[model samples]
Target chain A: MIEKIFVGSKKYWFWVFSLMALVGIGLCFYLEQFQYGLGITGMSRDVSWGLYIGQFTFFVGVAASAVMVVLPYYLHNHKAFGRITILGEFLAIASVVVCLLFILVDLGQPARFLNIILYPSPNSVMFWDMIALNGYLFLNLLIGWTNLSAEYKGLSHPAWLKPFIYISIPWAISIHTVTAFIYAGLPGRHFWLTAIMAARFLASAFSSGPALLVLLALIMRRFSKFDPGKEAIFGLSKIITYAMIANVFFLGLELFTCFYSGIPAHCHSFEYLYGGGRLTMIMWLSALLACLSLILLINPKTRNNTGWLTLSCCSVFASLWIEKGFGLVVGGFIPNPLGKITEYWPSLPEVFIALGVWAIGLLILTGLYKIAAEVKSQESNAA
Target chain B: MNRRDFLKIAGVGMVSTIFEPVLPYEIKPSKKRLALLIDITKPFDIKACLDACNKAHNIPEIEDPKHKIKWIWPERFSDVFSEQIDMPKEITIPVLCNHCENPPCVRVCPTKATFKRKDGIVMMDYHRCIGCRFCMAACPYGARSFNWIDPKPFIKGSNPKFPTRTKGVVEKCNFCAERLDKRESPACVEPSNGSLIFGYLSEMKDLISNRYCLRRKPDLGTSPSVYYLI
Candidate 1:
């Protein structure tokens, strides 16, 4: 089976090489960033994190939310998700790698990261976040590989892997919740200070995570023989619907609490996210796209339509990305405590560093999936 | 439940109870407990505080204007609680480090460089820091400042009274530890014209009780050191 993978046609090779080239381009950009500090990016004294940290914050939820689909399918005795669960796990791996790399790029002293492990502070939410993320990453890798190998070998997986898989389900939720505490625990940053932040993070991550899986499932079907089937896509989309509506509801709840009472601290982050103030452009764009995507996604007819579903997912992904990634952290700092509006925009070099980190994720994903495909092919040939 | 099970449970319960007793007074320790000054009423000026601190510490002109090592800027207290707010809370309190019992900045620090002193002052050992600035992110006060460009030359030209910071390290109000070692008050503490109060924890509380309106960010739980006369 693995033999067929190496014996594959030129197109497979083309995709592989294209990924490498993009990675190369991203590396060149990373070098420039290293030569200069974050000043090269759009980050200002007020806004410390630009695209790098924003993307990191947003995608970590995507990575951690993988457990949502994995839990019921693997642990609760649902075999229906057998086909796509592998894909979702792999996506989790890809997202986790990207999240770590983004954190690396965002650090003022990337090399000093060993200090995080050596000097762990139990009281800090960030310490828990690091533990959870690294634990989840290895947990998925160990189990996903063993299970896939067992499938290829036509044997029952080792029982030990089952416990880790079960643990990962709840562990995934822990990763994102801990990340939210990194913000909510802060005293002055109004946008992230809300008690509802962790709940909101989970709600949004579930929807967007499943939405991303749905989009990938469709792409897999079109581009290759790997059609994960309509059942898988539909099942994932249903999950998306439930989670999306919950996300929107939580969002509404956040707005109502902030606006009706009109506490100025609570109001500012929303204002920056919605339609007014310095970040209005990003806020309005995200809101518009999110609303439009919800319209398409809510209708079962349109939701199931492959083209519209993909479009809707991408829109929602971008919208949520903008809201959490681009807008939240920067907006939280605007006018600052000094009542001064300090603006930040990402520079080209920083974008390149981000692009590079994302490329690395894609390359890793492609390689892992490629190996899976090869091994699966060999097993079928043997049969 | 049997006696053995009850004993096990009782032992565990006793252990947990011994760890943390939030009870009002379960034998308050005898160590000289230090507290930060939190003044809620009156305007704050950096200069008067610096001068008084200089006189008290016997380290006059400790801050070199050329180095500009310390900064004291007026901030809207309203913004402290809400980001969307553009105005102050009408009555602004002079603010500084709350010297949090469980400081978040210390938690997120990748390098373990930033630490809170036993006396309720958040201080930094710059030598140990690798300039990661993650502590800056962990700080909710927007209190920590980083030296983006090299600060060595800038500080060198000043009074040479204070050493300049290097590029990449995070720095903030030290609560004048140098002065504390000399048995003097912080530069920020000396200039208070009854508007600000600097004293031990119990004394400050007595002062706060006597004030017209004494309040703090009830939600933060950090219990600040600087006190105001409002």
Candidate 2:
């Protein structure tokens, strides 16, 4: 079954080699970062976290999106999702790997990384995040591999996996929640010091995570014999629509609270993000696209059209990426602790490092998806 | 199951309970705990104190201020207190670690590397720090600094008494815990001519009782041990 990945078309080989090239390039820069210290990056004392942590946050969301498919299929017994459930699990495994790698590169002392586990401060949100992320990664690997092996042998999934499958649902929510707590519990950063932060994180995860999955499904249908099925895709779109609306609403609530109360610390970060130069344009553009996507997705006529569905999902993914990935971490640092503002822009090496991590994730996704697609194709041909 | 073994087990349990380390911040200051009081109303040269601290701690003289490792540094009062608009003469207040009763840095540190000592000094164990910089973000006073580059090259005439910090570790003024152990005042305080008071806050309560002293960002409920007398 594993040999199917090795036996592929020239186009498939091209994609695999391209991702490998990116991973190789990224590894070189990461080795340089390891040698020279994090000083090579654009991060200063003022902006301690830069592109690496931001990417970590984004990928955590991608990992959590797997539950969107898993819950409906396993809990509610939605049969359409049975075809694509493995895809969601495999996507999760890849995203979690990316999340862990981003953290690895971002560390100032990568060698001492295990101290977080060695002397685990249970009180720290980061400790809990480590547990949640590692747990989720293992759960997905176990479930994904076990189920795929069963499929290969033409047998039912083991009965024991059911308990673990049920546990994965809340474990998904816990991972994103712990990630949000990393920012929310901080004292000085007013932008992140909100109770709604976790709620906002989960909402955005639901929308952006599932939206990416939807886009991947569309691409799969075009390129392979495997389809996630119309019912499954439409079901996912409905989930994404509600979650995006909730995410937007949560952001509005944050804005209203910060402005209405007019606390200087709380209001300043928003001013820096939305009331200032290029950042303002980025924020407004994300808002506009989010609204446009929601409208497109909500209308049955537009949503039924493959063109609109793809466009809408892409828009939602982009909008949230800008809002959460690009803006959120950077905004929290502006109007820094002492009311001094220092801007941050990622260096070229940092960008490559991030791109490299993304390529690695896509490589894993491609390998996993190829195996699953091959198995499905074999079943269809036999039938 | 034997009586001697049962007694030994009970004794070990009781002794362990008695000796288990408690967080210093949680325990009320029964013994005299040290604190620093800085009088900013009078003009004083800050350069001398900054230099003394740099030399004492083996802090690097990074040419770029952006990457400089600051233990104790001067900050404009106007910037520190953004909401206040009163015409109290322009001033520079020396800011360092607050060694808070409820330190957000100590709380957020996953390895317990940054912790408050029994005498109320917030200290860092560099060997244990993974350099996640959660402490930097957690600190409201902008007190902590990270070793972004190798500090050894820039350190001019390294102090033999104090070990230099390596790259990829968070560091700050440990209230001169090493100096305190030697019965010497902090390097910065040694030069402040009587403007800087270093003593147990409980013992110095009579001295600073009526003075108009305030800690930075006191509203955050961190209960800073360092105070500024304006």
Candidate 3:
């Protein structure tokens, strides 16, 4: 099974090498960031977290979305998802890798990261988040590898693997919930101190995760002998549609709560995001893209068509990436605790480090996917 | 016993032993809760207090406002009390860490790097901090500052007695715990011309009892130790 990744087409090797090259460039910039300090990044005392944290938040959602497929396929016995489940699990492994790397890059003292485990404070949401994310990563790796190995051997997956698969469903939900608690549990930062934050995170995660999965499945169809089945893709699009709708509705709820109540502390962050602040343009663009994607997804005619579906999926992924990834994290810090607005923009080194992390994730995804595709193709040829 | 069961029992025992010390100990009610009261009504040299704090802590003089490390500074009355519409805009108030009794920073630190002492003062262990900035995000008051770069180059003259922070750790006013340990008043308090009052909350009751002192965002329930005498 491991050998399958080594044997790939020239194009596959090119893709692998390109991602590696990006990882190399990113590593060089990261070294510079290490030598200097987090000062090299655009973050200030007012806005302490920036691109690194935002990316970490976004990828946590991506990683948790694996449960969307796992739940339906395993518990509900949705056979259509069986072919795509491995893809979801593999994507989760890659996304969690990215999430952990983002956290590492964002840390002021990367070497002291072990302190979180050494001097564990269960009172902190960060402590629980560390447990949830690492546990999920481990679960995905164990379950994914065991199942894939069994498949490659043309044997039924072990009976013992059943309990682990079931546990993964709730564990997936926990990862995103704990991540949301990191923000929602904070005393200040009105933008994040909402009870509904976890719900909103799950909604966006479900939408963005499935949207990316659909795009990857389409890419696999075009580039490889393995076909993930049209029914599986259709099922995922339907999930994306409902999740995006929920995500938009949750955003609307936040708007109504902030504006209708008319509290300055509560409304200032939204005012900065949608009104005259620096993020105004980007925020509006995300909203526009969300609406556009919804319009395309809601209609069955466009939803079924590959071209329109691809366009809508791209819109969904981009919209949530901006809304949840960039806007949400930065918006929380805009009106600093003292009613002062301090804007944040990532420096060049920060951007490269983030890009490098993404490349590492994609490289991992490429290798894992390459192995799964080979197994699926071999099974098909045998049949 | 089976190997699995034995392993589980061993794990539980080890975990309990590790966490036994971490469990909350009884805090003596008689222990002093140190507090500070800033009398805005009195005329104090704000610049002198700020200078004293910087020199005492060996805080860097970074030119970039974004990366500036400050333990204490003066802020406009209007900006600090934005909720108070009737407040005078021209008046400047000295602001620093409130040393909240129920510190959100202590709650959010993953490694227990920032913790609330039994005496109701929040403390930071610089060596243990992972620099996640969770404490900065959690704090209601913009008091905490991270060492964004190597501060040694920016310090005009280093204070040998005090530890100058390296880059990548969050730091803030320790309520001059070091000075308190030496039985000396805080650097800022000494130069504040009696404007900044420092004492136990119980002992300072006479000063705050008669005056209408306000705590920053008192409604948030952090129970800030710093009070403002208007």
Candidate 4:
């Protein structure tokens, strides 16, 4: 199946080469970081985690979004999703891979990475996150592989896959919930201490993850024999619309509480993010894009048109990328624990390393999608 | 004859070595749980105390305040305890790790690298830390400092007793755990000349009871052992 990925159009090879080029550049930067310690990056004592951990948080949501496909198909028996569930599972695998790579690159002592496993502390949220993420990865691999191979073999999915599928539904929710707990459980961080944190994480993950998946489906329709069905795209749009709405509602709730309480600590991060700080432009842009996306998606007439739907999905993804990936982590540390302000911007090496991780994820996603497309094409031709 | 003679020599050597007993390494526990009492009410010279801590800990004198590492230093009373009422102006309160009974850093550390000792002193095992800096975020006091760059080059006249931290690991005031092992008071305590009290909390209860003492954000429930006498 993987061999078929190699026999592709020149554009496929070019894409592969471009990702390879990025990986090469990233490796060079990573080597420099390794030699000089984490000093090469833009992080300081004030803002301990910068771009890498922020990306780690974002992709955890992306990895967890496979639930949108999994729940409807497995639980509700939505036949429309049967064709594209494999794409969601593969996206999860790629996103989880990127999430893990982000963590690895962010580690100051990469050599001692195994200490997390060797001396596991049940008390730390990071410990549980490690378990949830790796467990989700394993479940996806097993479920996706067995089901796909069964389809390729032209047989019904094995009965044993039933329990695994059921387990994965909750497993997907747990991964992002635990990731949220990683920040939310800390006492000093006013920005992440909210009770609705896990809820917001899930809502944003569902919107962002599926938006990317939908865009990928549109891309697949253009390049491959797989149509992913008109109904399947519409089904996913409905999920994105509701989740994005819930996500925005959650943001509003946070703002109302922070401002109404008049507590300086509670209001500080929000003010820094939107009140003429470094992230002000990105935060406002995210708000504008999300509002635009919501307006487009909520209207049934606009959503029906594939062109409008595609644009809406892209907007939601970009909006969440700014909200979660760029501002969320950095904002939490602003007016740091001691009431001192320190700003952070990624260095060139940091940017390269992050790009490299994304390129690696995309490369894996491309390969996996290639195999899935090949199998789908064969099944259609045989029919 | 040659084989018998070698065998006899080897057997005697083994017997002789077995009779030579090895000496036991004694591990004595330090005096009862230690605490620090900073008497902010007194007019103590803070510079000497800060110098003593810097000298004792081998802390680097990095000129850039952003990257500078502090083990113990003077902070303004208004800056740290803004909520306090009737506190005197122009008084400097020394700030260091609270070494809390319930340490947030110890709880969040994934590798158990930062741990609280039996005597209620929070200690860091540098070798075990993966440099995640999660502990830094968990600490409410802003007590911890990370070596953002190699801390060695900036350090002047390094102390051989205390090991200089490498870049990436977190370090803070250990309450001079090494000094305690040798049955000496913390470096800052000695320099303060009765202004800073270092003793078992049980032993110093009378002194603390007489003073209007406060710990930073006692409501947060970290149960910090370091108390400031106002």
TM-score of each: 0.82, 0.96, 0.96, 0.93
**Candidate 4 wrong stretches, greater than 4 Å:** B1-32, B86-90
Task: Give the C-alpha interface root-mean-square deviation per candidate.
Answer: 6.5, 2.2, 1.5, 6.5
Candidate 3 vs candidate 4: the TM-score winner is 3
Question: Model 3 over residues B99-211: C-alpha lDDT tens digits?
Answer: 88778898788888888787777889999999999999999989999989988999987789999888999999999999999999989999999999898999999999999
* Residue-level lDDT tens digits of model 1 in A1-383: 33444555688789767878878888887666565544456765456556887788788888877787787788676676876787878889999999988888776556677766666555556667788889888987887788788887788689888788888888888888888887787776777778988888898898888888888777766665565778778777777777777888888887888899898767866665555575788778887887878888789999888888888889878888888888877777764544556666777777777878888988777766666655554555676
In candidate 3, stretches whose alpha carbon ends up further than 4 angstroms from where it belongs are: B1-17, B24-30
Clashing pairs in 2: none
Q: Which regions of candidate 2 fall more than 4 Å away from where they truly are?
A: B1-31
Docking class of 2: medium
Evaluated at residue A39, the lDDT of candidate 4 is: 76
Decoy 1 TM-score against native: 0.82
Model 2 DockQ, alpha carbons vs. true complex: 0.63
lDDT of 1: 0.68
Residues B6-31, candidate 4, lDDT per residue (tens digit)? Answer: 99999988987764322111123334
* Per-candidate DockQ vs. reference: 0.21, 0.63, 0.66, 0.27
Worst 10 residues of 3 chain A by lDDT: A117-126
